[model samples]
Structures are given as C-alpha cells and as structure tokens.
Target: MSQVVFELQGKADAIKTESTLSAFIKNYPVLNGYTKRDFNLAPYWKIPTRKKEKISFETINITDSLKNGASFDDVLTSLEKGINRPFKNRKEHVAFCLITKGEKSYLAMTFDHLVFDARNAETFLDIFQEDFKGKKYDGSLNLKEPAHLSMWMEKFKAGQRVNRAFLKMADKIPPRVLPLSSGRKGFKFKILTFSKKESEAIAENAFSQAGYLMLMPYALSASVSAMHEIFAGRGDSGNYVIPVSIDTRKKEEVRRQFFFSNTSFFIFKVEAGLAARFPELLNSVKEQMYSQVKADLPGDICRASLLMRIAPPSILGSLLKIYLKGQIASFSFSYVGETAYESPYFMDNKIINMFHMPRVPVPPGIGIFFQKSKENLNVILSHLDGMLTDEESKKILSLLKSRLGVE
Candidate 1:
C-alpha cells in the first residue's frame, strides 16, 4: 500500500520544528510475525510460525529541496519513484519520506501488502496519531493466528457451495463480457478527488434515490457505462462481473485477534440491460451485494485462506493466477465512512490531506479504490501498465467524473 499525507505548517513552526513523526515510526510494534514468507515442506507449503528476527525502519528528509515551493504532486511523484526502486533487503519492508516547503510538508509511507491491508493500515495510523499525542501505546491485544489446513478445508467446502450457487445464477442471466483492456503488462495508478461539499452532494443524491448511502453504486454504474461506451463499437455487450473486496475486521473473531490482513472478495454481477440508468443499476448491484453479505460469502472466503496450509504454493499460486487472469475483469475497494484520526494536526504540523491506494496486480487490468476522509472523497484508479492507451484512460476518467457529478 502507498499513501500521501500532507502536513500543514506555518513559517514559525517550520523553522522551529524537529519532526515528531519519527517517534511514532520508531515506537510502532514490530509485527514481525506477520512478515514471514511461505515455507516449503516437500509437497506442501506452510506459513512460518516464528517471527522475523528484526524490523528495519528508515526515514528520508527532502525538506531542503521542497523549500523552493514544490507542489504536492511533485513530492508524491518523487516518493513514488523512491518506492518503486528496489529495497536494500527483506527487512526494509516499511519506509517513510518527508518533504517540506516552508510551512507545508508531505509525508509518504509505502508498506508491503503482506503486512497490511486497507483497514489495518488505518488502525496503524490511529496508533501513530495516539503516539504523536503522547498517549500510551496499547500492547494487550494479541495477533491473530494464520488460518490452518483444517480451517481452510472447511471453508473451501463452503466456498464450493457458494460457487455452485453463483454458477446457477450466471446460467439464468447471460454473463456479460467485460470490455477489459487486452495485452496489459506492468501496473499504473491515478488519483482523483471530490471536495467535502461535492462528496456530500453525491452521497445525498445516491441515498435519496436508491436508498443506498455508499457511493459505490454510482462508481460501479459509471464504470460499467464507460466500458460499454468504449466497447459498443466492437459489439461486446455482455454482463459485468465485478469482484468487490469486503473488509472482515467487523467479524468477532477477527476483531478480537487484531487480524491485520482480514479481507475477502465477493463477485457482484449486473445485467447489461440495467447498466444504462444509475438508480436501477445501483439497486441491482446493491441487492446482489447485500445477498452475498447476508450469506457470509466473505467469511467463507476468509476461512478458505486455510488452503495456504494444505496446498503446495506452486499449485495454489498457479490456480489463483489463472483465476485472476480469466475470471474477473475489474476490482473495486472502498475505504469510505468514518476514520479514527479526527484532528487535522499531527504533533505541530497540520495535516492537509491523506489518502491510500492499494497496489493492483495484473490480469484484472483495472482497480478502482474510494476513500472518504471527513467529507472529502478520494478516487484512486490503478491499472496494469499498457492496459489502456493514454486517450482511453482519460476518457474513462471523464465518464466517472460526469457520473459522480464532480467537476
């Protein structure tokens, strides 16, 4: 995961301030148990039981260069470049870069997804904020155990049932061919945002008409419309199948253990006919989503993680790769709603804005992430490199903007 956090400061604060951010970074729990790689045991692979010996942390300061009035984009771009470069070693899984220009500063953090998911990442931020405020760190919570083989097999059997149900549903409605971009290679990402007023308006409109408070209906509908427009000339009108990610932190067992990587995917299908109108399409999507949630599809998937303990990594990895390449055309994740960090200031530096973008893997080609901080809504577009030409990417962005009523 990657994030861009802006620090608002004044000239006096900038001149006098020594970073309070470092303390939070240094004091964070090692969480070494979560960093272990899969171990080979002949025909099967097992998750390591032992925690890593050490955790390395580094912070780079670019305040001198940014003093010339660099834009946030410039700082973000630089930080991204640094993140893309190879790390010195395995222990270097987390790092921070600080950029400052007079009173304003930007802090970027890049973390390996193996150690953090979107929800847990927010939890880490809360911990950091508390530490910055001189609050005591809580160490009583225990880390969740990784799913074992028995747990996975049970869930796998349940997931099989869910898949069977999904297959039956697909037969009733002809599956839509998602107009996915072909011949994509590396990954690429883009970010778009809506102001507090605009985000509120969009949420209000969606809720009033569709009885849905989330902006996903609007976002998904817009994406479907845009893809349909892009592929209409090609006669590719098929049903859309989107695998939406569900955060499992709300689960009693998961929450109790402080599970850091608790997430599951549920397939959301919408007929091509309903894709034209926002409200109807939103309702259709919402119904399917709610049905799966009620059925505990995400929980089943979470339990299925036990497969890691029973299956050989090579075979399991290949199967998953094939599924990602052929089954789904797009993915969506939302981190909208309330956040724990309420204050705009962290230590002496004011926070200008903060947003996170999950890394997108290939085969699906495109990922859309939505995060709401206070009233501001941020949209992150991550896709495989070469998935869409420059013009195609921009056109899709324009379509989403229009759909969301964002200028």
Candidate 2:
C-alpha cells in the first residue's frame, strides 16, 4: 500500500448526522470494502492488491475526555491522535473516527494514499452524501483493466525515445529545493481560505484574460515564480521544476472507476530568464502542462510501474528515497471545482470548514493543496515543522494570495 498522505475533517450535527452517516456507510457496501480492505505487498514490488475484510465504523464520545468545553484545536488534536494511530498490519487501509465534544461533533477520515487519491476521496464524499439523501448507489464504476505486465511492456517500449530524452534533460538541471529552514523534525499544517467573492474574482479574471478553463496551474506557476524571485534575489538565475499531481479519472478509459490507487505526476519547469509577468508565466505553464498531457505522460509514468516487478525491491526503495530527498522541490495538488457538500449545511449542522493536508517529505519539505467548494477556495500549506516557521508560512501564503490577485 502507498503511504497515508493526508487527513480530511468536517463537521456535522451530533446524533442525527452521525446516525445518517453510519447508515450511509452501511447502504454503500463499497465504502465498507474501500475502508476495510488490506493491501498485500511482499515477495516483490509487484502492483499492490487488496483483500476485502469486514470493518465497522469506529465511533468515539469525547464529552468526558474534554474537561469543560474544548476548543476546535483541542478537538482536532484528539481527532488526529485517534485517526493517526497505526493500522493493524495486514488489516484495513482506511479508517473513520467520529468525535463528539459537547454539542458539536467532528468527522475525521484517514486514507492510505494507495487506496484513495484526491479525486477518489471527493467521489466517495459525493456517494456518501447521495446515500445520506436516501438515493440508491448503482455501483456503476467502469474501471479499465489494470496496467499489468503486457500493457506496461508495450508502453515502455513505445516511450523509449521520450524516456531517454527526459533522462538527458534531468541530468542537466538539478531539482529545485524550496528555501525552507533546515533541521525540521515533523510537520506543520496551515489552511488559508478565500471568500466566495475572492475565489470568483480570480476565476473570472483568468478566464476573461487567458481563456483558460482551469486557473490552478497558472496561479501556482505565478506564485512559485514570485516566491523564487524574492528568495533568489535580483540577479540569480536557474531552472526550477515543480511536480504537480494530476488526476486521471477524467480520462474516458478510467471514467467512474472505483479503483483508487494510481500515480500521475506532471513535471513543470520554470526558467528564471523567461516569462516573468503573471500572464506570460501562465501561458508558459499552460503550454508545458498541455504538452505533457498530449504526450500521455501519466500513462507513460504508469508504464514505469512495471519496473517495480522487475527491479529488486531494496534497490527501488533506496532510489525512491534519494529522489524524494533530492529531486523534488515541491508538490502542488488542486481540487478546484464543485464539491459534494456545497450548501454550507449538511445533516442539520452548518458545515463550518473542510480542508486536507498532504504529507510533506523533507529536504523539499513543502506541499500546497487547493480545494474549491461552493464558491470558496481553500488552500492548505503543509511543511516539515522546523522547515517553515509560522511567520514564514504566512509570508509564502501571502505571496500566493497576491499572485492569485485575491488580495
């Protein structure tokens, strides 16, 4: 199984909402299996497979745990503790925790990255809401055949020239590392949310000026460029790469697939000598991103998965560790679109706020996740603890906000 990359939290009215959610879980058996299945990864680095198992919703009452009234932070801390507890080996890959503090209750779900990527998680929430509303789940996920031995071999052979070109390019430019404080131990999480008007303004401006359907990559490119300029000073120049995760579910072949395990990364390179203005930088980002998409980089990357079966597990693990520590500067993931719970109210409780924090690997030590719900945009900045102090995090976020024209 892949690593547990993030945690998701939301609020709902205590008793009725809890009952409804529990019922929803029961009604949608897929959710149960998705949460309960155990991954088998041994013998070799073959594609991980899951075995279904029985798992029930885990509920906790913290009314007595909190001395008087607990603040949101207190509740969050407790929820994190509960959900982050290590799962039993060879057991479930997903877990749910319901925490109650006084009259308010919180729902926290933890997922193994292999089991649920951002798109799958959001789709799960949609199904949960549908089940809660008394709708039947048709279970119409049309998953394509898994990329097995033959498929991977075919793609690998076809992409040999492209892969060789990418290797040559990789050798010339070193991976760009963010200017974060060193000696960080753990991780720090922060969420920056924009008002409906601010989010709308950013979207409208991008569409009106560039005719771009998605504004995230442009905004991200502009922000990263602005931050690099500030940190690198006036005269320094270099090439930098930002690895952006792209969801593949939108592809017709994988449409509505319930399978959650997949890795699709697009590497966008920004050169200091070119595209300084926001608009120019945006065009550059779009061109590079679209170019990679046209090349079917995601499928090509998936083809590389076959190497897991061929290479020695020990060697593969070591190489991956080195890559994570040295070859990646930062990660940017965005889920910018409508979400299931857009009404601000769910199950009779005002859905206060919802956000996700992706795991931040050190050396690079920073991750930016964006989610748009209703008309609001929620941005989460996660960094290795000592890598970025609170003030520094705020500053980076401020730069991003200014770049997005949110301020």
Candidate 3:
C-alpha cells in the first residue's frame, strides 16, 4: 500500500493532542473502516458505527539519538522513522508519531494514500485543529458515497479515452525509465525551502519564463531540466514521461469528500531531444495541460477508475505493471498547489514549518513534489534508497534551484 506523510514541527502537548484526535475520530466513524469486496461485487467500506475508539499513536523517546557513533538530526531522524512505519493493518489507515527533543516537537502523520489524498490531508488537519479549538464545524455524515454502478456506457467510453491516451504514449518513443532494483527499497529525500523573498523572485522569473500564473509549469520545467542531465547521460533518447498527480475536489467538497482519495493524474511526456530546451519544455507542458483540461481528461480518468473497485489491490498493481512495461515513468511529478491549512498556530503551538514526505510507489520509486505555504515554496526530492546517493540528490536539487533563479 502507498503512503503519504506530513511532518509538522513545533511545540506540542501530547496529551492534549491525543485527546483531540480521539474526539475527532469519534465524530468521524469512517476512520476505522476497511475496504472489502465480495467476488465480482463492488467494494464497499465496512465502517463501524459502534466500535472501540482506537488509534495508532506512538511516542518515541530519543534516548540514544546516535547510531554507530554518528550524529543524527533529531527532527529528520524521527520523521524518517515515522514515515517508514506502516499502518498495522488495512483497517487502520492512519498513524501518528510524536517525537520530543527537549523543547522542540515533531508530529508525523502517516496516512494511507488510499484513505486520503495530499490536499485533503491538509484539510483533515485543519478540521482537526478546529475541533481542538472547540469551534463548530460541518458534520461529516455526507461523506459516504454511492457504489456508482450506473452510467455503464459513460464508464466504458471514459475507459476507451484513457486507454487511447496510454496507447498514444506507447506509440511514441519508449518512455525513458530506470530499472527498479530488487533488494531493500526505501526513500531518501531532500527538502529545499525558499525564503519568502526568494520565493517572490522565483515567481517573477516564472511569469517571465513560463507565463503569468504559470508557476506549476515553471517549477516542472526546472525539474525536467535538472533530471534531463541524468537521463541524457544514460545514453537513451527515449521520451521523458511524467505523471502529474493532482487533486480534483472543489473547495466546497472538503466537508463531504474527506474520506478517500480524490485525485487524478495528468500524463505529460516530452521527447528526450527537447527536454533540455527550457522554453520548448515549458510550452509543451502548458499546451498538454491545456488540452487535457479542455477535454476533461482528468475527470474522465477519475470516472473510469470506479471500475477498479471490483479488483483487489494486488490485481490492480499487476495491471499497472503490465501497462507500464516493467517501468512506470521517467519519474512521478506533482505540484500540490498552496496548502489549505493557513492557520498560524496548530494545537496552540506556533508552526515552524511544514513539508510532505510521500513514499512514492516502487516501479517509479522517485517523485518531485512542490507545495506553497504562506509566501514561501517548498520543493521535495524523493527517491528510493539506492536510486540516488546523497550527493546525487543534493546535486539534482541544486541544479533545480539554480534553474529557478535561486542561489
């Protein structure tokens, strides 16, 4: 199962936070539900309206912060461990780890990607905060959705369109992708945070280079340019394929759509020969996104995805593997846009900073994510343990930073 994690750093009161979380879960029974499907039947969540209130919350004490006599950063080490810890079972789709380092506190919420997408995870937090503060909020009873068994022709047509898109991709150059090594698999990451001033400067450069209000294209172009070096050096002139994950929920849907994943992928590919040209890549991405959005490709894909509710997760993975020809993409890419949790304080503690650490799935065990908080932008470089060394990761990010006009 894939996982998405959020690391919020600040001071914390564990007892208070735990109580608030417990109350929050009681208000939303879907937290303890599990997805199950009978043979050939549509999957439905087995949510218990009367079950024990149990949550996976662990408090780790860093008695020995050092391993093998090497120094370790408290926050990162804790978060690395927190994100690595999977949910105990499918029914438990979320887990919390609170790490205390003297006065500094780090809270890591590791969520099952099947349970919540990236954007809604922030909304989940925001609502939790509202609950903790004793503020009234909308009821969550409207979150339950239908099996959506109707509209057969619409689904088949949507599937046809999505399949045609994939066929179109395969007709082009074979996607350039690295072989996923078998041994141990885990992610190594690099977080690049731009200061407010630097972020503004990059916004200016984005408008000048990509276009007005085109920050997503600008950031993506920079990352593509950064990764093009590695791809080019590998001596393969294949098309660079990137799947952009995006949220499809409206602002008003937050109250009713917080239970499951509400996201879609935008398939963006550029030929290796043109990947290095900033202007060309930017234009290609913009044009591709425009055409897809205009054609409602993302919406169609989401509608088609309902057909998978009958298949088990294992089968779904197998199908995806066959579709990708043993390679998923050049790499995964996404821009989460601005975070929705704009509160200055969380659980009465001033938030120092926030960043997402998603465990990008294995076939494509690498991802570059961008999100904005306040006026600053945070970029993350995540890849499997052996996919890139520490030096290589920093260098790739450095290249990205330089391309973004940041020192």
lDDT of 2 at 179: 58
Against the reference, the lDDT scores of all candidates come to 0.57, 0.57, 0.75
Count of residue pairs whose backbone atoms collide, per candidate: 5, 0, 0
The TM-score values for the models, in the order shown, are: 0.77, 0.74, 0.90
RMSD of 3: 2.9
Q: Which pairs of residues clash in candidate 3, taking residues 3 or more apart in a chain or in different chains? A: none
Model 3 residue runs over 4 Å out of place are 1-10, 38-40, 61-73, 171-173, 183-185, 248-250, 312-324
Point to the candidate with the largest lDDT: 3
lDDT tens digits, residues 1-407, model 2? 11211222344444565466555555333333322212432222123244233343465565544465656556645554543356664334556666666666666566656556655665566566666667655767643343354565676664573455355435344554555565334456666778888988888877775676767676667567555644465333456556676553443323256446544777676765553566677778888778878877766666665656544546644553354444545444443344433334444455655656566544466677677665677877766656555677777788888777777
Per-residue error (Å), model 3, residue 84: 1.7
In candidate 1, how many Å is residue 230 off?
3.8
Compare candidates 1 and 3 on TM-score and give the better one. 3
Which residue pairs of candidate 2 clash?
none
User: Could you give candidate 1's per-residue lDDT for residues 162-193 as a string of tens digits?
Assistant: 55645544533334443455533344566676
TM-score of 1: 0.77
- TM-score of candidate 3 on Cα atoms, chains taken together: 0.90
User: Any idea how many clashes model 1 has?
Assistant: 5
Q: What's the C-alpha lDDT at position 321 in model 1?
A: 36
Candidate rank order under TM-score: 3, 1, 2
